[model samples]
Target: MNQKLKKQDWTVRVLQELERQYSPSRWSHRMSADDVIKAHVKALKEGTEQARDLAQTLLNVPYGEGDGEKLDVYIPKTNSLDVHLVVYLHGGYWQFLSKEESGFMAVPLIDKGVVVVAVGYDIAPKGNMDLMVSQVRRSVVSVVQQYSHISGLYLCGHSAGAHLAAMVLSTDWSQYSITPQIKGAFLVSGIYDLLPILSTYVMEPLKMTEEVAVRNSPSKLVPQLKLSSSSCQIVVAVAENDSPEFRKQSEEYYKALEESGLSVTMEDVANTDHFNIIEQLVDGEYHLTKVHR
Candidate 1:
């Protein structure tokens, strides 16, 4: 076979393998995948509703001029000088969820005087991968600028959201006016490399090409990451029951960060799948939630 045909053949085989490995719902050990997702969404909605009632929320605050470039900010009831802000990115394969269901994790954090910002970005079918990544990066910059008085800035994301958070960490902040002082990051069940996604149905709506995937892949962008905050801590956590590919990506990404001399750790949360792994963030006592605090 010619070079071009050989490459195409390899791509076909990789895609077939990824299709099985990347399908989280298929590997779910809990209830049916659909039921698990439904329960997860319900939890997110209820938790966010409770968070709104508990905190002084600033809803739909625009970070950029675009309609989807808005975020929901949850502020603690008691004002303190030592405020920590956490920017959360929701994951629905970069297409499904929205900020409306993103603030669930704030319920526990807010009571402890942590400000949580649930970011809104244009998801797939409407927004491309590049645009989503840019929006997330810009949202963090906007949050940092808006809350300049904040003592610490942190980041958290689930699945696709985690991917975006990683991208934000690997950002070339020189393009922006201010570089955010990110203190810590929590990445849960995320996809670090996008090449495998190209062959999966998940990429159908996002329409990412090989070059686009390569450019946005955090696993590939570790060299460009500006680790200005030597103390910045990155926790790459994977669900116990997550698909093999998901765990592989988190492990690989953690290794890459460790090799780069960045402060990073890997967490294998026990007895959890992709959906519940993040849904548990609503619980204050959850292992990952405790780490967030």
Candidate 2:
């Protein structure tokens, strides 16, 4: 394999081992119930709320009804926004965290008078990748429908969330008949390939077969979007202190998108880790300002 591909494979392996240790499935094996799915969801929800509660004074907004895929809005009460709706997708390797966890990151953007929606979704094992993605899709549709005045839809997602955000914007809106355009997408340390993550610990929850992995990966799908989308902005970001796997995907996907003639911007931030990198978006000290270009 070439140096780039070899590097990609090694990084994927490292994430797999880390995921194996932290995946909720590891906790499920000990629960020993036919419907351990609920148990897993409950635990993840508790953890997600704890993360959200860490931030003081967050407004819980139901993008959909009755806590069904709710998005937490953490903006200022001043109520001034004329730009795109900045929807943030939180990353827990697609199994943990929620809108609550991401609200902390949105605090600054919220304060910036930008409409920030931290989308929460069901995780894997209980539902699988398709269901997880479906929840986000539904949330976006609801946001546009419910908030009709919003002119544009922009996305920001970290890690696995970043991957999903990329997919959402890469969507062919013409096929969906959605009127509001997807203005731009910001993918912070997202994963775009799964070959390296397969067969490792993360796979149990992801249940990512080779076929599904290839189909979902943005690296594979971005090339096929030119027919439907030609003028979308994509910003692929990485922190200087992020894992090798994160850096690998951020840089690789950035290059791929740039090569495809998309307006792609890649940012490498200093002194930031994976979890805190999203903070830079709201803080303005981070590269998200660069990403907006």
Candidate 3:
């Protein structure tokens, strides 16, 4: 075979491997996909309840004109103009989940006197990729604008939310007439590239085309140095038991950021699966939680 043909063959094999790797059936252990989902839902429910009980929360605050353009704000007792704001985007593969399911991680941050905003965006099948990205960007802008005295803004997201959070990093803030004072970013178990996703079962509801996939991929859209904040720190983390693709995505993204001369760190949360990785944020002593401090 010619060199070009060998390259093509290699690409085909890699694509096939990605499809197999993304299949939940191949990765899910003792629990089936349905079982994992049920557990996630239950955790979110409990977390939401705990958050409401622990913090002074303002629920369903409108950030944009759309129905899904809403967020839940958890304010700590020490909230002031000088306090930092941690904005979290919940992940449901851009198809499911909501801001309400995000508060479980707020308790620890809130206890440390940080404000937490759980952002909501329109989901897929009904909400296209463009709309979802726009909503997330708008939500961040809304939080920054509303809290004029905020000291620093920290962006954090889990799974699909991490992808959206990364999108915010690449944004041209000049268009919005607001330069966000981004202090740091924590992206947990995110999909940095969308190419592999095209071959995954999750693509059905996402309705992703090659163009759309390329357009929205964060790894593909590196932040322009002039637009990127110099002081902003970044961390990309993956769970120990996360699929090989998930771990590879985080590693690749971290490498991309570092090669671009950005201050970025890569973390492997020990002994965790996809679901519990974000759940571990509730523990202040965890390495993932300590990164915020």
Candidate 4:
């Protein structure tokens, strides 16, 4: 085969394999993709609403100049001299979900005196890969700046949001005025490599090229993470029922971080799939929530 033909053949095989591995809904025995999403959205809505009433919330706070560059802050009812802030990034394959429905996890955390901030960034068809990454980085910077006296800073993200959180860990803080004192990170069922996504149906709205995928992939940025976030403890968690590919990616990324001498651990949450693995964050007694506490 010619060079072009060889490339075409490789792409075809990759597409087929990746489509099966990346289709998280197919591996889910509990519910169909639609049902899972509906439940996920309902949990987010109810949890966020409940959290609003329970906490001292500052909603729609802008972190950047962009329209979508805003975050919702949830402060605990009982003020404490020492406060730990957790910034959450929601996952909708980078095309859906917003801060409004992202505060569900805050419900349980606020009761423990943890302040939660749900971050917002422009999703696909409106924002490109580079722009979203930049916006998230700026959001963290803004958080550190706004809360200068915070005792510690943490990051939590799910699925695509996990990818974004990993990217944040690999950021070059010298470019920004402030280097966030990140204490730890929770990455749940995330897609660390974007190359496989480029060939999947999820690529339609994001419109990422090979170069974009390569640059944005958290797996490829592990070296930078070693330099920038070596002190930050990272927990890379995946649902037991997640697609094999998701587990593989998490394992590989954890290995990479460990090899680079960064503080990282891998968690395989039992009896859960992609959606509920994170949705259960609303429950204070949940396994992951306990881990957070």
Candidate 5:
């Protein structure tokens, strides 16, 4: 079978998994998109003190900020080293969390002696997914411009953040000339392909137009061009205990990247969950050790 054809088949499978598409009411529990968003916003408002403290530290690190969107840069005060600037994009499933919940990201990256940047953006409903990516790219480009010593940059995100990281890097960077210094990217348990979400109307606040969903998918984007092995490091790491749907999504995404002739790597984190996987991400070693290795 053709690789591209196989990908098309994979997309169909994702569509089948989406509840609203196959059956709307029961899946959504008769909740509207607004209802879902409100519930999430309420929970996030009660944030942890640890996250807030870490954000303050990150705000102090010196890195250029872009006016178009809000972001926090965490450059180790120590000075230049052959270090990777690891950018952490927070995931709220394209709706919820801020860079603060993932504050622990800065400590590990800095401990590894890498520069870290945690970007914040207006949540969806006010800004769509495209807007999210645009702001994230702006933040990344801003960092790249000021930090000439960013030996290699790594984009890492969780959940929805994972999706943004993947979408942002899937592009041909030279076209934008945003960074001549990108090393690679690590997308930990990302929803790189949105066919699943598209099957339901729940993602509409993302302003996920049909065209955007198709165009933004990493699996869909890789087939159209030739990318260099050195241009970027691509890794998709998913926890062993994620839902079968997510597991398949992870497999489908990595397989698409590989089949399309992209240099990619996949890791299944042992004994982890959708929420607990990050516990092991900062370890500096693991099955996907090459991410920091």
Candidate 6:
């Protein structure tokens, strides 16, 4: 084949590999995709109950006018210092999950004298990427405003939620009349770029266009940080069993931030897949939680 044809063929193969790598069904031997999802929901339900019994919690506080624009706040019973806040956004490819599944990580953080906020936003088909992004932004601002005594804010997200968390890092805080009080962010198994996802089977319901994909990609949207000190505080992490594309995306995002003079750390989480990596947060000693602390 001619060199031109060879290059075109290679591009097609690369795209195919990306789709295969990202499709959770392809990795179902370890656990079925359906089971992985069920595990999350089960953990969330258990955690929600535990959160109520273990800590003082406020449920379904509205942050926006939308039906899903609400958050669950978990507060520790005992604390000697000004408590900080850790806001979690759950992932379901921006379509499948809810804030109800977000409380699984709350008990551990709350135990450390940190307030945990699990945010809810409308998912896809019913809600677009723009709407989800906006709701999360509004939720963050609302949380900060609601709790005036917070020492700082930390953002944690998994998968698509990680994408949204990265978007939060790029936010123009001036627009909301709020200072960027976010002290750090832990982005786990996230999709930083949506371009590859658009070509994958998952995008059918997301109905993403090239324009939307490019515009919302966190890898492509790293903002100029106002302070040098604030840049390095973000942590970018990927799991041992995460697909090659997922790991690559995380590395690429970390490089982009570093090259832009932003302070970012890249971590390889061992002995876990995409699903269990976030679940690790349920255990306080898990490296994922350590990163946040």
Best by lDDT: 4
- In candidate 6, what are the lDDT values of residues 23-123, reduced to their tens digit? 65345346777787687678767876777778788999999888889999988986555888889999889888788778878768777888899999999
CA lDDT, every model vs. true structure? 0.90, 0.66, 0.85, 0.91, 0.63, 0.82
Best by TM-score: 4
Worst 10 residues of 4 by lDDT: 20-29
Tens-digit per-residue lDDT, 84-134, candidate 1: 999999999988989999889989998799999999999989999999999
Off by over 4 Å in 1: 1-16, 226-230
TM-score of 2: 0.74
- Model 4 misplaced regions, further than 4 Å: 1-14
lDDT of 5 at 10: 88
Candidate 1, backbone clash total: 0
Which portions of model 3 miss their true places by more than 4 Å? Answer: 1-17, 24-30
Question: What tens digits encode model 3's per-residue C-alpha lDDT throughout 212-293?
Answer: 9999999988765225655789989988878988889999999988988888888888777788788768777878889876
Tens-digit lDDT string for candidate 2 (180-290): 466788888778876667766668788888888877777887765444345667777886766566677778888887788888888787765554466445445555654
Give candidate 4's TM-score: 0.95
TM of each candidate vs. truth: 0.94, 0.74, 0.91, 0.95, 0.74, 0.90
lDDT over C-alpha atoms for residue 72 of model 3: 95
Candidate 6 TM-score, true structure as reference: 0.90
